[model samples]
Target: MNRLRTLLFSILFYGLSVPIVLSVPVSALFGRAAVVRHAHVWALMHRMLYRRVMGIRVRVEGVVPPGTYFFAAKHQAMFETLELQLLLGGPAMVIKRELSKLPFWGWAAMQYGGIVADREASAGALRSMMREAKALKAEGRSILIYPEGTRVSPGEQPPLQSGFAGLYRALGMPVIPVALDTGIVWPKQGAKRPGVVTIRLGEVIPAGLPREHIEARVHAAINTLDRG
Candidate 1:
């Protein structure tokens, strides 16, 4: 049953994404609004697909906050990104630069105003990300970064990278700690499982909290949810 759902979801997803990918260049030629509107629709479609594919429902806790702020969200599965797209206003995702090279998906990402960061160059990447983040924030776009950097498999929390702290320090804005158990249903890089994915949004951690302290708290919050 899980495999059937996964197959059905994959078919529907690719079928839907192909038209969007093809239209990206046309959208670019026409106007930026085309891309934004299409992307927003895609987000809604993905949300429906997520629910149908995994038989999982997302329950968000607390307000996601209004206006531009850095979203220090935890990464357990790709589902988080889909949810982020729908809920996060003026969304600008911080994604791996490599994903920007993919054919269709890359064009769509670029068109939709996603931020791509090269993970290889330590200093250069950080500076570039911060610069882009600041510009995006200035434009009223909320930034989303997964402190874990990559998907954490079930029952594990990869060592929280200091990049997040560095970003928080540089940005000096309220960091909203998002805790979600995506692996409960999404299962990183595997067949979808049936269950519920709970996303808890904690109050925005005010600026001036030491970087390490903020990182620790974010880690602890996600870990607490993962363990539960």
Candidate 2:
């Protein structure tokens, strides 16, 4: 049964992931680039398991923009969190502060160039996030954020989280909105279905737009694949 397959896949995937996550410290010893490169391997491993075990395939459409740009994607399942990073050639992520402090995974993510955002939105936290974002950009890396803050079911579309707009204004990178129907295949709390999860990149929205304008544009763009 599919439940048996999902259970087996989860066991294999997470159990196997420990070694690579543990190896992050060794990579970090080499430097940031080393750590980022090491992360690619981890992401690849997860993708392979998703395909080989769960029969899930990711189909990405539309050209990834040429240079530095902020990417906002609809959060439907856990798939896109790391998949998009791999798809974008390891761009820095904007993760929540708590997640950025986990253990080896958190440490590795930070070393791999993630900006840790504080959900409470203190002035200091925002400033820290801005500094990290600028550092990533300075290194020619873009940022990938799930603007709705948390994953929603496939048919639901939540408004963009405030942090996304703030970061967009701070970084001023052109936005590339990505839409994915990941929940159809990987639900929040249910059996995993085997199917193609589509990630579509919508038209670019230029930087420096008014907050209201950019927010609306992003809200519409990242939900393009949602039938609702």
Candidate 3:
């Protein structure tokens, strides 16, 4: 019965996401106010979907800093992207190319200030991302990114990818390490399990740190949560 419910809800969730994303332009034409409202509305809907369909509750810790600092969070579940802004305000994400292929979601994500990347297009992608990140920072938007590049399985830990270190070095931005235990509840590719997921915010790793140091600190912070 649980499986049936989850499957049904999952189907509905993905089915609706497409149209929602594609309607961004139409939603914007209604006016700027409408677009802002739509983003907030969708954030709420995203929370509801995860709670109802995925059976996962989020427990956040520590205070989210003000202004634009890069958020280096652990990636372990599909819900990470959706629930990013739940408690943290003004936070937009750096997402991968696969998300952009989903018809409606891709559009909506773009509209709501997400930074999408085409991993295959290395040089071009980095240039574009750096430009956007700087511009968005000036506009007071926090940038959230999963430094690991891909979701880690429940029993496995993936090394933090180099892109994050490169971004920090290039952007010269402070980074907040967010530790989360999401795999237990929202497994990378499996049935959702009912559980409470805790996301703990660590100390700020200031900018200008050496590349090797930045990589090590970020990796340690994420691994701390994975073990806890």
Task: Please state the error at residue 37 of candidate 3 in Å.
Answer: 4.3
lDDT for each candidate structure: 0.77, 0.87, 0.75
Residue-pair clashes per candidate: 0, 0, 3
In model 3, the runs with Cα more than 4 Å from the true position are: 15-19, 30-37, 52-54
Q: Write the per-residue lDDT of candidate 3 for residues 35-100, one digit (tens) a residue.
A: 546766666777787788767688888887776688898888767766767566647678787886
Give the residue spans of candidate 2 off by over 4 A: none
Q: Rank the candidates by TM-score, best first.
A: 2, 1, 3
In lDDT terms, how accurate is model 1? Answer: 0.77
- Comparing 1 with 3 on lDDT, the higher-scoring candidate is 1
TM-score each candidate: 0.90, 0.96, 0.86
Instruction: Kindly list the per-residue Cα lDDT of model 1 for residues 1-228, writing each as its tens digit.
Output: 899898899899889978867877777776655677777777788888878675778887878756567777778777788777776664778888889889778867877777767767489888987887777667667778888888887678776676777778877788777888887777767688777777888777887787678878888776768752
By TM-score, how accurate is candidate 3?
A: 0.86
**On a 0 to 100 scale, what is the lDDT of residue 215 in model 1?**
79
Cα-based lDDT at residue 225, candidate 3: 69
